[model samples]
Structure formats: structure tokens, C-alpha cells
Target: MFLLLVQAISLLLVPPLQSYHLDNAFGNPESVWNSLYYVVLLLLFTGAMLIIVRYKVNWLIQAIMAVAVLSTLVYVLFGLAVLLVPSVDPLIAGGVSVVLSLLLTALLIVYPEWYIIDTVGVLVAAGASALFGISLAILPTIVLLVILAVYDYISVYKTKHMLKLAEGFMDLKMPIMFVMPRRWGYSFMENNKGLPAEGAEREAYFMGLGDAVMPTMLAVSANAFLSAPPLLGFVNVPALGCILGTLVSYVVLMYIVVELKKPQAGLPFLCTGAIAGFLLGCLAAGVRPF
Candidate 1:
């Protein structure tokens, strides 16, 4: 029950990075380069993870996990603090941001509890979501989501690289993915026997943050760029639709994980839901489908 609440709260606290990335991409082609850079980072991360898994070096895994957690904390703090701080200059903001982020990161390195991981995850998720949402327009977000879904399918089912990625990441004990334990004193490190036995049902669950972030990118993008009337709390038709669709998709996915006892690539379901909702929103707003 607590874990379930944590999941919901985590989603609420962290906005995905997709929206901010989208906004930047919409602003300039350079922004697309920036997005591509992250992909490179992810690929690099994937490679390192493979190496870590292949060799079974526990200490290096822990070190990488620490670095990832710390880096995420930096971005999370900087993004949120920039909004509240007095100075608007990028330089001053950057300095203060670095200091604060490092402080938080240092704290996590010293002591990492469940609360700390979840808090950092929420902060990072929000930063990423806002960044991508603002940069990506409706069409781009849709395209990105579709492309990612296909990639996820290939990675998870065909190439089988994604499962490897998941296994390696789980060993790191990072919050890049949602972590839930079915029972008390369950150690992710010890129980990390691999990605749930390939089809076996398990009480605990771990979902890559990417799964959550990718779909929400469309939601935030639709809201930020679309000119339609606000449907809920100043968000426009597209935004409302995207949010509803995402929640619908999340619920469905969670249900499948819990009740259906099946393994599935989440992006396909999420993207489908978001696209359908976006179209419906376009119709409601009297906008012709392009």
C-alpha cells in the first residue's frame, strides 16, 4: 500500500523531461542535437551497464549508481531553484545551481534511503518532463514517442538488449527506475537474480523512468504549444487529452503487470493512448486533423 502511494506521488512530483526537450527542439535545431546528445548518453550508459553485468564487478556498479543519483539530483535542484531564485542571469543561476545540487548529491551519497531515492526521482522526472514538453510541439512529441515505442519493443523483445539493460541497472540501486519491494527488508542487490524470470509473476515491480517520461512528454507538449481552450486548470484541449490518456495508459499497464501476469513493452500502450487522446482533443477543439 505504501509503495503504491509512493508510485502515485512520484509521478505527481516529477514532471517528465520530454516537455522541456520538446520546447528546446522547437526553438532551434541545436536543441535537437541536445536531445540526440542524451540519447548518446543513454547508449553510453547502456554499454557501461552491459560491461558491469558481464564482469559482475559489484563495486563499480555501486560507483556508477552513485554518480547517476548525484547527477540527477543536480539537475533536479537546479531546475527547481532557478524558478524560485532572485537572479535571472544564467551564470549566477548556474553557479548556485551547481552548489545546491552538489550538496544534495553529497547527502545522498552519504545516506541513501527509500525516501531519498524517491524524492530525487520526482525532482529529476519533473525537470526532464518540463524541458522536453516545452521544446517539443504536438507532432514532434508524437513522432518521438512512436519512435521510442518501436525501439522499446525491439530492445525488450527482439534484440533482448533492453532486458539486459534492466538487469544491469537494477544492480546499480539507482532511481532511474521505479523500485518497489513486496516485503520488508528486501534488498534489490541480493534479490537481483534477473528480470523477473522472463515471465514469472512477482510481487515487487520496477519500471524504467523512461516509460513514464516518454508518454508524459506528449501531454506536456500538447498543453504548452497547442492554442486550444483550457480544459482543466488552464491546460488546453491537447494537454487535457494527453494527461487523461497517460493516466488511462498507466492504469492499464499497472493492471496488466499486477493481474494479467504478463510482460509487455509499455511505450506502445502509452503512445497509442496518447495519440488517440490527442486526436480526440483536436476534434473537440474543432481543429481538423492534419
Candidate 2:
């Protein structure tokens, strides 16, 4: 539901983002080449992350994380401030957001309590999801999701390096994943030793922020790129379908997690749900998503 709300808001933000010429990341919405470039960029970044982890470059990793957190907050806050405070000077709004984002990023790095992590993680996820959604149209977004889902599967099962990355991230106390306690008085800062074993029962449940962000891009894309009449607020039929499909898939994914009790790639299930729902919605609306 949190994801849904965020994406819905993102759909609305598309127009304001467009006012700032923020839509279409490459200045072209349906560029297959741009999508491929994005994938390659992801691959390179992953390789760099792996190397940093392998070398135990904790400071470098933390520094990188800090910059990333600041940038994400800046993007989210700048857009929001610009929209909400139209009377205020744009520079002042932007300055205020940057200052606030800096403080939040500092706090996240310095403290990193569970509540703090969850709070920052949600804002960051929402911002990233919405940014990518408006940036890519339906087809390119689909391509990105498909490639990510496949890569997630391979990195989890075949290479198993993703698990390692998760551990490194946890150890660094990064807020890139959401943490929920199963029992009272659990401290992620102090008690999070590492990723639990396959059979181990964890004190907390963790979901990668990316898991939520990936499918959301599709919903945002559907809303932004397609010109179906708005059914509720800014939501169109196709975008609504993607949202519902993701929610349904989330339920199924939870069931699978409870039953299997092992690490699973979420993008496969989530991306498929979003895509399927989108196609069905396109059919019902008599419009093409692409």
C-alpha cells in the first residue's frame, strides 16, 4: 500500500516534473538504445560495488552511500518544494531542501536506527521510483525491469554475490533496505549480525528498497506515457491495473516467502505482475502501452 500511494503521487508529479523538463530521462521516451545503456551502466556500477565489498573498502562504501542518499533526498525534496511552495523563490526552496537533505543524510549515516532507516528508505525509494518512471516510457521501463529481474535471479542463485552485497550493506548500516521487527525490542543497529541462514528464523524481516522501486516505475510509466482518461485523480486505467497487479503479486510473494523461507528474487514476480496487469489494462482501455 505504501508503494501504491507513492506511485500514485508520482503519477501526479509527472506534470510538475515536466514543467521542469524532468520527464524523459534521455529527452526521448521510447529509446531502446537508452534503455540498453542504462542496463550497461547498472552492470558497471554493480561490478564496482562488488570490488569495493571484496576489498572491504568500508569508508569508500559509506562515503558513496552518503552521496547517494543526499542526491536522492535532494531530487525528491527539490521537486516537492518547488511544487508545494510556488510562491517562494525556487532557489530558496531548493536551498532549503538541500540543507534538510544534508542533515537527514548525516543523521542516517551517524545513527542509522531502524526507525530512521525505514523513514529515509521510504522517501528515497519513492523518489527513485518516480524519477525513473517519468524518465522512461512504457517499453523502455519494461526492458529495464526485465533485465533487472533476470539479473537479480542470476546474482541470487547462480553467482550468489547479491547475498554478499546484502551482507556488506547491512554491516555498513545502510538504509537501502526496509527492516521490520518480528518481536518487540529488536535493535537493527546493534542486533543485526548479518543475513540469516536459509533455515534460520530472523528477528526482523528485510526487503530491499529496489524490490518496491522496480515495479513502481512501470506504474508510473503507464500513467505518464499513456493518455487514457484519468479515472481517479491522475490515475488512469492502465496505471491502476499495474498498481493492483503489483499488490496482488506482493501478497503472493509474501506467501512464497513464508512457505519457502529462503531468499527469493522479487523483481521476477513483481515485474511480471506489473507487465501482465498493464497489458490487460491496455486491452480493456483499447490503448497500447507502448
Q: Which structure among the candidates has the greatest TM-score?
A: 2
lDDT (10s digit) by residue, model 2, range 54-130: 99999999998889889988878877787777677778877998999999999998899888988788778878888
Off by over 4 Å in 1: 1-48, 56-72, 82-100, 107-112, 183-194, 198-201, 231-234, 260-262, 288-290
**lDDT, each prediction:** 0.62, 0.83
Candidate 1 local distance difference test against the native = 0.62
- Cα shift from native, residue 63, model 1 (Å): 5.8
Candidate 1 weakest lDDT stretch, 10 residues: 1-10
The C-alpha TM-scores of every prediction are 0.74, 0.95
